[model samples]
Each structure stands twice: as structure tokens, then as C-alpha cells.
Target: MKLTKREKLFERIENHLRITARQLVKFDTEEETLQYLIDSSRSELKCDFVGIVLKEGNYLISKVWSGSCVSISESFPIKIENCSPTFLNKSITFDKVDKDTICEFSKLLLEENILTWFTVPLKDDTNTYGFCIIGFMNYVPLLDEMNRVFEEFGKDVAVAISLSRRKEVQKNKMMGVEWISQNLTLDTEMDQIVGKLVERAGKGTNAQFACIYLYNERENCFILQTPAYGEKTRLNKILIEKNYVLKEYFPYLETPGGPQLTVPLVIDLKTIGVLHVENKGSLVFTKEDEEILELLSNHVAAMLENARLYNNEKDHKQRLHHLLDYQQALVKETVEKDTFDGIVFTLSRLFSKTVMIFDRFMRPISYELFDVAEDELHTLMELATFEVYQKKNRDLWFSVDYDRNMGVWSVNGGSDLLGYLAIDITGEEIDDFFKLSIDLARNIASIQFIKQKIVLDAKEQVKDSFITKLLVEKIEDEESIIQYANLFNWNLFHQHRVAVLSIDLLEEGTKDNILEHQAKKSLLWDQIKTRVLFYDQDILFANKEGEFILIIPIEKEKEKPKVYWAKLYEEIKKWLALEGDKSKILIGISGKTEVINDYFIMYQQAVQALNVVSHRFSNVGFAMFEELGSYTLLHHLKDSSIATLFIQKHLEPLLKYSEGKSMDLFHTLRVYLNNNGSIKETSDELYIHRSSLLYRLEKIESLLEVSLNFAEHRFDLMMAYKLYDLYYSNTALT
Candidate 1:
């Protein structure tokens, strides 16, 4: 009555076949059928566990499990890292899984003490659903008879899973449609509607992350109508547009991390936006998820259309009237030359709250204090700046953890994000009238800011033109220069010095890098203008030839112009975080010139001084025209022989004797002259003993027939050494 191993397997296979055929037909859903398969298969194989895993987009997700497990659950996703679907789909055998090259999920089972497993691809004629897996508590061979039973089960389960997913799709679609139908109202903001859509879609479709993006034509970026991804705590502090590029609708591609599913929201024949989702727990996206996503996207489009039609029909005239009324009030206030603070104060009184105004760059320009506490105002400003950095787009929305009583809105003109207005409604209530007044105030403020910016820009342009002409030696006369200068409200007829801020940013010269460099220049310009203590002396700033030129008038109480210039240089270096040794920053200053016509000479001197920093004097960083001692003489000398003559007159004998040598004599002479004939210092400079340096200096002095101690002799020798290094580039020294 004892049965053989082959006979026992045969009986077991027959029983499993019978169970799958009968139960698969009777089960109402894929989940129910999968539970039955898991239970029946585990019993037939006497395995520890039976589970069904199917490919969902880029991940393998568990659908159902029967037996106990330790390491993993249904929530765990089989991440496809080492192997891709292309490799698995082309496996030689559908039933036998190569243990060495098993998927990540199989490895997890082995780690949990399930040493052996047999998985069959759950596939029909055209589609592979996933894998139907049975794990063992002990080692077992993958046999032919096992595949026969599991293959039948896979075919049946594939059908069940396909049908079950269709139901899931229908359920999700119906929910989205129902939600849209109930929420479509005349006054619903598109931003609010999109936020709800993302929330519901992520939950309903069981996605790890979801997003609703609308193409902001003005920004040339995809605006997140909802949270870009995940909860606020887990959201990436990076721009979403950088992660996802906008392609034509329905384009499928792989991201740097993995695959993503994109569902285009189209209205009529035009694609308006995108709905994107990635991962479902540990599982990839499924056909059901994609269908549901697309269906929801369609509903979103429909909702948008409905809202647009509603606004056009019902609120068009009212909106126009409100805008008109806002414009009239702004006109009345501005015609009276209301200051920025005055405007802010009016808005605060209208809303019966504190208000703060920021420029386009997020620098607070004005505010209405009106009983606001100092500590509270300070905290609000700090929080506002932090939130501004977190914004992916320029539009303002009071969506952070700041006070909900605060009403934050953008002051936009056309597509430009002009500025922002934040109203503190801490203890007050906001009605429709308050909201309307705020909208008008922000619009008026933006207009006023732009107007002021235009005037400043015009003045800057005039200043730049005048400076450029003066620097290029194109000024016809002092009168013309003064007339051009008067248009900018700047007095040029004062003793002034020129300072050149020279920065060479070494990076790959890409277009994006160029744009970034330009932005830095703009920011640095703004910072310099804001922080430079003008001190009753006017500063004219200009950008030319990839550098900044500052024509600063001399203060009446200054001691020496060079000391003041060097101090200013150090201050700028510290503020920009560009120390002399670590970063590439060279500042040059020209000596003071009294006449307006003589400023061109000072500008030339500053340019020459900055140029000398790259070529001469090892200790030079902050250079002045007066400090460039030998460089000025050497630079003006056009005759090469004249430079050679000076070198020969001072130390011709040493230069001749040092030829074909290590330039030891030239090195000894230069170091000796630099240390003012101090044998010990010269020894330190050359890393030689003092006695050796004294002996070398004696030999050199004997050869040149000059005393190294005399000031004129040392000066001539130093000039000769410097000139040799500059013109010959160490050829004559060697």
C-alpha cells in the first residue's frame, strides 16, 4: 500500500488540477480565486506558502498569499533592479525559475528560510499577468509534473486577474465622475479642485504618489495644481519640472529612478495638462491603474471646462465691475502720489489688519504696522522668506503652516510675477468685500512697483551710457558729460576713484551656466548697491566686459583713497564669501582724480591694475594703481631691449654666469634683494643655510661689482630680477 515518490506527485498533480478547474470557474473575483488557488496549491504541494505575484508596471506585487511568512507581506514590492522585464519575459522556460537569477521577491523568500520555490508565469495567449509562486519550507527540485499543474492554474488565474482588474477600473472611474459631479460649482477654484483630485486619485488607485500638473504657458513650466508628490513632510525639496519633462501627450519613457505612468488631460483635441503616478506600494502600475488614471484625467478636464463656462456666463460682468472699481480707487490714491508705505497702510485699513508688501525678488519693500507687534511681524517675515524658497512657481499661495488667518496673494501683471501682498487677519474675519479690496490693492501695488522700477531702470540706463562713453574715451566735452549725467540725477564733477570688481568664473560654458552666471551678477549688483555706505558720496555702477566698474566719489573726510579702497574691497570679499586665497576675486582701485575729464584716466588705471594682478607680484590681490610699482614702468615700456638693458646694467655678469645652470645665482640674487640683503631671510627663502646664502651673495656682488647693502643697488637688482621673470619667462635666468 506504500506509494512511490513519482506516484505521490502524480496524485497530487491530479488533485490540484481538479481543484483549479472547479474553483476558478466558481470564484466571483480574482482576489477570491487567487485565495482559493493559494490555499489549494499549498495543500497539494505540502509547501510552506503559496502566493500569486503579478507585474504591475515596473514592480512585482503580491495579490494573495495563503501560508504564513516572516520576512515579507503583501505590501512588499519586488523591486526590479538587477533584471528588467525584458529579460524575465524572454526566459527559456515558463514554469522553471532560475534560482541564481531569481527576481528580488524570490530572494526575499529564500532569506526567510524558504529554500526552494517554483514559480510559473501567469499568462494567457497574449498577456503575462505575473507569476504564480509556491514556496517550500525544505529543498525541493522543480519537476515536470509540478509545471503541468501550475501551468493550468496560471492560465486560469491570468483570466481571473484580467477580469478583476477591469472591475477595479470601473470602480475608480465611477468614483472620480461622482466626485467631479458633486463638486462642480461656479465659484470653485481650479487649484482647490485639482488638489482634491490628486488626493482622491492617490487613495483610490492605491498609488504611492500622484500629481496634477497644468502647463503654465507664462512660466513655461508645469504648475503643480496639487502637492507635487507625497505629503508635505516627505515632499522632495526639488522642482517637479526638473524631474519630469513635458512631451507630447501619451509619451512613455523611463525616469532616472524608474518608469512612470502619465495620463494626459485633454480637452477637445488639445492636451491641457498631465496626471502622473508612480508605484503602488511595492508593485508597479497595472492596466487597471492606467485606465482609472486616464478616466479621472478626463473627468478633471471636464470639470475645468465646466468651471470656465460657469465663470464666463455668470461672473464675467461682475469681475469686470470689481476690477473697474479697484482701478478707480488705485488711480485716486496714486494720483495723490501715495508712497509705498501709504498704499500698504490703506490696504491694511481696508482689510482691518496688518499688511506687508514684497517686491518681485521677495525682498520686503513696505508694510502697514497698525498695532502689529514687533515680535509677531519679525516671525512672519522670516516664515514668509522660507516659504518663498519652497515655492516651485512664482505664484503666491498661503499653503504653508503659517497662520491660516493670513491672506497671501501674488501681485501679477500679465505673465510676470510682480510681487506679493500678505494680510494678517489674525483676529479679524474676511468677507467678500475684504477679498475684493485685497485683489484691487495687490493689482494697484504691482502697477506702482513696475512704474517705479521702470524709472530706476531708465536712470540706470542713462548712467550706464554715460559711463561707457566716458570709459571708451568718446566724451566730446565736459559740458556734454555733465548734461548726460544730469539726466540721471548724478553729479559727476567731484574727485573720484574707479574700482573694478573682476571675477572669472571657471565653469563649463553652457547656456544654462551662462544664465546662472548672469543671475549671480545681477544678485551681486543688487547686494552691492544696497549695502555700500554711500556716505553723501554718489556711487555710479556699471557693467562692462564681464566685470563691474564702480565710479565712487571721494568722501570729504577720507584720509587716504588707497586705504579706503582696500577696506571696501575686503568688505565686499567678506560679504560675497570670496576670500582672497580660496576664490577667484581680484579688486583693483585707481588713484583719485579731481576733474570730470580726468576720470577716464582713473578708469584706465584701475583696468591696468586689475590686469597686473594676473601677471606680477605674488602678494597682490587687492591692488591699486599707486601700489603697482614696477608693473607700471614695465607695462609702459614697449622696447624689449630697454627691459633687457635695465637687467644688464644692474646684474649682467650674474645673468651671463647663471646661463646653462639651475638659475641658482638668479634665485639667490632675487631672494637676497627681496629680503633687503638679510642673509637669514634669504636663506629661508631659498631653503639654504645662511652661510651658503652669504657666500652666494658675496660671489654675486663680486661678479656685479655692486654692494647688495645699498638701497639704489638693491632697487636696481630687484627691478632687473622682476623684469627678467616677466619678459624672458626665466629663459635668460637659466
Candidate 2:
């Protein structure tokens, strides 16, 4: 039916809102519905301009608009009272600009050449969402009637806004679940999981600020897991310093600015971390929003915990597999390979670090450098000193460097210390798995060392037997001795000299404990053997109970054997001197020989020479059998009981008489005999008066019941003096 202009406008408003309400429910989000409503009002409802100002806390935020001035109409914020059901109970129409309508919302319409406008509260039975404003540039009749119709239309728009938001919320919930199910797997990294978690939380709750903070148990603090909306550094500092204060506001905290929701990512009654979400713009978070985020947090926490478990299991399996492979390869390499290179190479590859196998002296036996520079290796080698390792406990892994980035494990072969296994830990974190891998490697190294030691010890036994038999002349055939020496890679047929080294390792009275003494002796012997082998590895060597036998090959006969022996003696003396003054090394060398059977005789001569040096030449470190002169005779008589008695019979009388006396008669008599019984020579050599020397001589002659004038008495006394010098002399005659 045809009606007046006011009735016609009312009918048009009803018809247009009815059509727009259907389309509004079709849209999925509130923004889409709001935009369609504004567009329909401006085009079909005969309005010059239309805009929606949604209530956000105590302010009205111009959300959407449609007009020529739409760009300037959107996002205009005006401070206002909080929205309530009774706050804007009716449509308020402004026919002209006045002081009551001179606010920011009116200014926006004035800028659009809209002189007339009315704002109606967008509300339903339960809530007043905001206001819908319709404006016109010119005045019109029935403006009050049009405002009434527009008020009714605004209710439909408010209901549409609510339905669309619910639909979007449901969609986000489904999408969040789908994202967790599809994207989060055992293989997902923690960063990816946390990133997705934070993004989904923000979307599900319509939050402008969202972040996840994972707890670092080692650091005892919360580390921000994803990029946060606010100042990340400031948030982190606040969270770290005031974690308990933040925790007191668990679930949600409403402030004057806005509302904040905090939900912990809990699993099995334990909180691993927290999920935080703040409302966007001027909106406030509801209890329902808190529940949604909490649900998401639960799922994410489970996923995070599962991911951690999966990674841990995978890492353990990998480490165990690597350990098994290392063990198998170590066994195979120890059996088939001749050295430790293969083992260390495999270990370096497994750990992705530089690996080294060092001997007891901290000398690297085998090493594999993976991505290590030569200069860095040199530094590591220099830092790994014998003194450094010796100060640490053995058979355990420990940080060896000052930076605590290097680890070393001592390898032990039963009672013997084999070596060490070391790795560079810089820029890496070491877990129990890492330690376990190193422990397995060192244990394998110990086994390899023990295996090698077994072979070496057996070879040493066979070599010792062969050498003992050769030295004692038990192997009668020279050909047999030559074959035995060849077994040790020695050419016994060459011109060689035998050297007997007697080591007086300890002082006369040092340690009374036998075990400690033996241990020190063994250590010293190892040092000496290592030094000698370093000098010449091909030299034939045998270890006796009290001495070490070395058969030194003479390369050139042009130089006298004494020259070669003198050089060797100086070297040995120098090394022994380094051992300290308490230790003395006396080397006695024999003349060169071509015959293998003469080796036995050379050994005897060398021993006799060592005995002479030990007994008569207390000031000397080495001596040659050829250089012994008359002292060579003392070798046989030195061990003879008859020689000892004869020496005691002559020298004992003189020794007993000279004691407590002003002049030494034994010294005078020996000088007299050495001077060919020339009285003047004896007196001059003695640096004494001839009368004093004669008195001492007469006393010696009377004590022996003989006269110095008789040759038999002088000869017997001379022979006795020679024996006395060989057996009884402690120092050289000065």
C-alpha cells in the first residue's frame, strides 16, 4: 500500500535489513558481515554515508564505513562511556551541528558533508555491541521516524555480528586442532612446534599478542619460545625476574589498558611452559577465550613432551648404535689393522670432533682431525702434556683444558696405563650419551693396548730366552745363535761389541719398602729403554735382573772401537745425569768381534770391565776392557775367594795400622811399589819428606814380617797391593 514518506522509509529499512541479515549469516567472519551491512545501508537504505563504531572497552572504534569519505571514516577512535544495554536506549538524531553533537564521531560525519545523522545502539536482548550511524548531507522530513527504523535494523546487524563471530571461533578451533594433528609430529623440531603453537593460539583466541615461553630446567628460567608481539626483550626480563608475580595472575589478568590471558602448557600435572595471549585493539578477553587457549596449550604441551621423548629416544638409539659400531670396528681393527688409526678415525667421524690416542707419555700415537686446523691441533697437543694428564684421575673422562671445552679419558691395560682418548668439545654440548661414547672408546683402546701388550710380552719372553742362551754359551752352535738373532731382526754376523750397563738406580739408603723400590726401578728402566730405542731401535737389547745387555753394531772399522764407545758413553751418562745424582749408569764396552761365539766372551769381558769400573774407578761412568790394562787381571780375581783373602791379608794389616795414625802408610807403600822401589821417586810422588816416607815404609815392612830390599817380599807386597786396589779402593788416589 502507498503510504507517507516516513512509512515508506520504515518499510524500505525493514526490507533491506531482512535481505542483508540473510547475507550476513552467509559470511564467515564479523568483518565481512559488518562490511556488507555498511555497503547495503549506504546503497540500498538511501543513506548518504554509513559507518559502524564498535564498543571497545570505554571507547568507540570506527571499524568499517562506506562512502566517498570512507577512507577517513574508518578507524576513528573516540573516547566514550562503556557500552551498556541502557546507555543508548533510543536512536539519537541530529538535524544540525550543535554543542551536544560536537564530538569526534560527529566531526567524522561533518567531514563527509553529512549535516544530518543518527546513532542507534547495536544491541540484542543480552548485549549492546556498539552503535550503527546513518548520516545524510541535507535535512529531510520524518528524520525521527527514520531513526526508529534504523534502530531496529541495527539490532539485526548486531545479531548477525554475534553469529558470524561464533562461526569463526568454531572454525578456528577446528583449524587449530587440524594444525596440531597434521603439522606436529615426532619429527617436528621444537622451534617449529613452538612457532605453530603460538600462531594458532593467537588465531584461535583472536589475540593481537601471543607468545609461548618454555621453561629451561638447567637455567631455572623461562625462555621465550617464539616472537612476541610486545617488546620481546622487556617481556623476557619481566618474565625472568617476576615469574611468580605473573604466575599469581594465572588464567587471566584484566588491566586498565586491556585483558591478558596466561595458560600454562601442562602435562600430567606438571607445567612445562606457559602460553600467553592478549586481546587485540581495545577488546577484552572473555573467560571462554581463556578456556580455548588452555585447551590449545594442553595439546601443544603433550606434543612438545612427545617430541622431546621421541628426540631423546632417537638420540639414544643413535648413540647406542654408534657405540656398537665402534666396538665392532675396534675389535676388528685391533685384530686386522696394525695400528690405532682406523679406530681413531672412526671415532672422529662418529663424534664429529677431533680424536686422539696418546701414549702414557702424552705423545700422540694415533689421531684423526675432523675439520680441525693445523694451528688448533698444535695448540691442543701443546696443552696435552704428561704433567697435565698425570695430575688427573685415570680411566675417567674429565675436562682437560682451561676453557672446559676439552675432555680426556685415560686408557688402562690391567695394571699398566696404556694411554688416553681425547676429544674437542668446543661449541658443543656433552650429554651422558656423549660421555658414554667416549667411555666405550677408551675401554676399547685399553683392550687394544692389552692385546698388543700380550703379543709384545710373549715376543719379549722368547727374545729374552734366546739372548740369555746366547750370553751363557748355552747355544753351542754359532749358526743357531745367528738364526735366533734373526728372529729379533738382528744381524749378529756384523762386527759388534757387547756393552753391559749397570744402573745404580737408588741411593745407598732411600726407601726401605721393597715394592716402592721395584716400582721406581721399573719406571726408570722404561725411561732408559725408551731413550735408548729412540737413539737406535735396531740395537739388540736384553734385560737381566740387575743389568741391561746391549749388543751395539759397529758400522765402520776405520774408527777405533774406543771412539764409538766414548760417544755412546757420553750420551748414556748425559741421560742418566738427567735422572738425578742419586742414579748412576756405568757402561762397560768390549772389543769388536766378527764371530757369533765370541759374543759370549765379549759379554764376559764387558761384565769384567763393568766390575772394574764399579770397584776401582769410582770417579768414572764407563770403561773399556782393552783400556783396563793390568785391571783386566782383577776381573777374574775380583770374584775369586782366594783373591779376596789375599787382598784382605795384605791390605787389612795396612788398613788397620794406618787408621788413627798421622801418616797413611798404605798410601806410602802403594806409591813406593808403583815407583819401581825407587825411594826418591816414592818420596817425591808422596809429596812428603824422604825420612817420613822411609819411616812409613819401615812400619809397613815390619808389620808384614818382611824387608823391602828382598824382591820376593816386594813382589808379594806389590801383588797384594794390586788386589787391594781392585777390591778395596773406594776412591781414586789423589
Candidate 3:
């Protein structure tokens, strides 16, 4: 096959135009640029086929084709190494035809007829973009005129494409800088700015959809704010693929579709987000589109940061104001008495939920719109004790949920646990309100504690004053003492015993005079109650009369009644020593009598005994009975000497034998006495032989030189024994 000059010249122009268009269109952007280049080349070359294939790394895709002879498959992927010209030429070829190259190109083109083929590498300065192919049914000879024209056109196209790309790059850079500056100055926040930026970028590149999917480094996932058309609705419906391309990459790039493009939003060299542009019209995005999207991504990254900062600042200011208000409330002195109730009320009103104040123990103090029964309060109090209180001075607010319905705020006053506040903010913003109220309540508690201390001190002083005056103004008249006793609510009707105590103040000196007297009265009262059951007794001092009155029951009106007198005397003496100074104090015990009307008799008797002991005795302190010994002595003697002598004379024989070491004699006497001097009982008690017991008794009568068998002798002996036992016990002697 031979080619005419006219045919060669046209083919040269066609090749030149295709190269020119390829350079004019950015490979990274509009795929249509390649198709347009193929169309123009096919029209001028008058060939059976012309097509442009694009290389992406080692893989080649037929980007554009124009020919009636065959249709280039869009989906078929070709390896750069397997392409015809890639194997044929290790160097540049000009106006040269080769059998292997032609055959390889023809096969790829699917041309069955004989043909000549020409292939050119789409060489840019750095690397091959792709290749151009032209096919003819007949072989053609290269003409000088056509070769010159082809060389010149190819050179011009290459320069034009390179220049066009540079121009496009500069334009994109300027637009990106302007967009960032404008976004920074706009009132829109980072999120809104990024959304709008991506949308605009999509529109600029004629994309079907756009989205700014923010990258969460912590989560290592993309978070798309505004999903492309139907994407958000389909998110749940669509299966997330392992390597799902962004929606904003290609038009008509559906499920199992054509090529797509995605640009990462890199700021500071880190991918913080992605810019997605979808071309739904079989439009694969070009390099220029990628460059523009990348520039837009930078602006989006900055805007996102700005928005985050703005939101943080706004939130910080809000928290600051809230804290300030809380602090002011804490310091305010006008705290409602029912702080818990007030908190509940305020919170319920503010947030429309029930609120409660609890102590650190989580015991609800007061509550609003809640049925807090006494038992519940107690239970809450018990729970509250376990909770920790955060100090009001510090910025610590702790919360806990005791149950589904119960929320607790552990209020504090510095490090010390004050108490807690609780509320059932079941459906409210409880967190913030509780913190504020609990702090306020803590401050209130501190102030209340101080106030209570002051009040307690004042009450103590008042009590001291009252007691001092009461003790000092002694009433002398019986009626007056009774009236004074009545003031203390003492019962005066029943028989009572008066014990007078004269306390000698310690040499170191007493405390308050009133306190000392009060202490004495208290001690006396305590002792009397502890020792005896004074069901109805009144103790009072008769100042002018100088007597202590004791009124006691006299069941049998008898003279010289001894048991009652002795008991009264001993107990009074002990009481006086315990209440007063043991070394220097006089105590007087009045006789027991049932003389209600004759109060003066008792008073006089007591006073006389006290005076007699004080004035007559040289002792620093003496009991009354010790001074007036007339009746006391007669009582002692009656139970002593006469009784002892009578027994000794009558039982002299028994006594002498007992003294002379006859053990049986003492046993005999004891048995005889226990048995009322009956010989039969005496014999039984001694477990003795009867005749032997009678013989011992006879000996006892002989030694005593008295008749023991006589009643009078028996009585005398009995009295003597009683007297001696009493005497020995008192004297602590055997």
C-alpha cells in the first residue's frame, strides 16, 4: 500500500491536534479532554481508527476513541508494557513504519484488513502520560513536506499543552489562596465553611455530588457531615465496602462502574478529611480537578479547626459564667432554712424536675414535689453518710446514682465533708444545677455551725447565773424553804430526813461561788437518791433558824428508839464527808418523827445537835449525837456492863471453864442460849449424849455461882451476849 502527499499531510495535522488537545486537558481532571482530542485527530487523519489511552502507573485505560471501524472498550485495562508502541520503539521514531508495530497496533485496534500504524508516546517532561495510535488500511510512504509539517505541529502542540497546564496550575493556586482568605474572614463556622467549600469545588468541576468527610484520627474513620444525594438515606442500606471510593470521585461511576477520583484533605501533611466529587455523567475527573479539590481541602481543614476552637471558646465562656453565678450564691448570707427543699424547688422550677438536698450521707434533707417520709429521710440520711462531700472551695462536684430514680450530689466544704444534696432530676439537666446548689448549701452549713456555737456559749452562761443566785439567797422560814423547794418541783408531803453538810472549800480556792454551791447541792441530791428512796422528800437550809429539818416516819411511838437513830447517824456522817471536807465539816442528823405540823420541833432538834457538836466538841467537825451523850450513853450502858455483869455472875462457872480452855463449855453455852436454856433442845443442838449434856450444865451453874436454870438469869445472860457482840463489833476488837 502507498500513501499520497495530501493524505500524509492531513495525518500529520491530525496527530498534532490530538497531542495539542492532550496537553491542553489535565489528565488528572476532565476525561472529556482526551475524547475531544481523539475526535479531532480521527477527523483530520482519515484513518480507520484513532484513540487515546491513558496510563495510571503501569495500568492503561482507553480514555478516548473516535473511529467508525471499531469501538474502544472503556472497561478493558491494558498494561503499559503490553501496548504496541511500548514494545516496538526503544527510541523515538519519525515517519517510520514497522511490520511488528503495525501488526501489534492492528490487532489491538481489532482491524482485520491490511494496515499501517503509527504510535506516539504522550511524553511530558517527567514521564509518559499515555500513548496515541493511528491506523490505516494501506501502507504509506513518508513525504518530506508531510514530515516537516508533522514535526513542527507535534512540537507546537507539546509546548501548547505544557503551557496550558502551567496556566491552569497558577489559576488553581490563586483561587485556593483567595478561598481560604475569604473563608477565614466569613462569619460561617469551620463546618459550614468546609461544607460550602466542597460543594463549590464539586460545582466548579461539574461533579454530580460533593462531600467533606472529616477524618477522625482517634477513631481512624471518616465522618461525613453532609452526605451526597441519597447517600445519607442509603447509608444503612448500603454495605460499607473495605475500600469504598468517595462519592465525589466520578460521574456515572455507579456500582461496578467507570473510573473515579478522590483527593485527600491534607493540612500540615496529615489527612484530616477527604474531598469527594462524583461524576454521574461518565465524566472521569482530570488532574486539574484533583488539584483544585486538594486546594479546597486545605481551606476546609483550616475552617474545621477554626470552628472547633470557636465552639470550645463559647462553651468555656458559658461554664465560666455558670461557675461565677454559683460562687456568688455560695457566699450569699441569705440561705433558706430548708436548703434541700429550696434546691428542689428551684431546680424543679428551673428544669421542671424534682430536686432534693441530701447531706454527705446522702440523706435527703428537703425535697420538692417528692414524698419524703420520715422513714425515707432516715434511710436517706443513712445512705448519705457514706457519700463523699466535695469541698465548696475547690472545683469538685461529684454525682452518683443511688438508684434509677435517685441522683446524688456529694456537696463539700473544702476537704471536710459537709453533706450531700440529692434530687430526682429524672428528666432534666441536673448535672449543672446540682453542682451550683450543693456548693451554696455547703457554705450555708459552715455559717450555721458558727452561729450555733455562739448561741451554745451564751446559754451556758445564763444557766450558771441562774444557779448561783438560787443557792446564795437562803430562806430561813419553814414556809419560805418549802416554797423554795417547791420551785425545784420537790415533793414535801412524805416523811423526809435532813442531813446537814458543811463543806470546807479547798485551800486552793473555789471556782465561781455560785458554781461551787450548785455543785454541793447537786452532789447532796445525788447521794441521797442513790442511797435511799426519798419518794417524797424536800431538802432545804433554814438560814435564820440555823437548822436543817428532817421529817421521818415514826410507826410505833416509842421513847429511845435506837435502830432508826443509828442508821440515820452513820449515813449522814458518810454523806457529809463525801459532799464536804472530811477533815473540817459538821453534819447533823435529825431524829425520825411523824410530826408534819411540828416542823419547828424537828428543825430545833437538828439545830441544837449541830450547835452542840460545833460549840462543845473541840474537834474540827463532829456529829451531833457524839456531843449530847445522855440518851446515847444510857442506850449503850443498858446493852453493856450491867448486862455483862449479870451474865458473868450467873454464868461464872461456864465463863471460867470457857476461859480455862474447855472447848465443850463454849459450845454448851451457845447451844443452851440458842435453845432458850432448854436441856432437851440444848442436847439436840450439841448432838451430845443427854446425861453428859446435863452434867456439863450443872458444872456451868456451879462455876457461875448462879442459877442458870432461872428465867431472870437466862434473860441477863442473853442481854450480856448481845451487848458484848455489839461492843466488840464497834470497837473492831475480838
The TM-score values for the models, in the order shown, are 0.41, 0.71, 0.45
RMSD for each of the candidates: 24.2, 7.7, 17.6
Please list the C-alpha lDDT of all candidates, in the order they appear. 0.66, 0.72, 0.52
Q: Rank the models by TM-score, top first.
A: 2, 3, 1
TM-score of 3: 0.45
Q: Write the per-residue lDDT of candidate 2 for residues 534-631, one digit (tens) a residue.
A: 66776777776546788887874246776766676677777667545467777778877777678887887887677667755647678888788876
Candidate 3 lDDT, 519-618, residue by residue in tens: 6655554344333333224323332222223334443224444555555556655754643444344555555434343343444345445554554342
Q: Number of the top candidate by TM-score?
A: 2
lDDT of 1 at 53: 70
Q: Is candidate 1 or candidate 2 better by TM-score?
A: 2
RMSD of candidate 1 to the truth, in angstroms, is 24.2
**Where's the lowest-lDDT run of ten residues in candidate 2?**
230-239
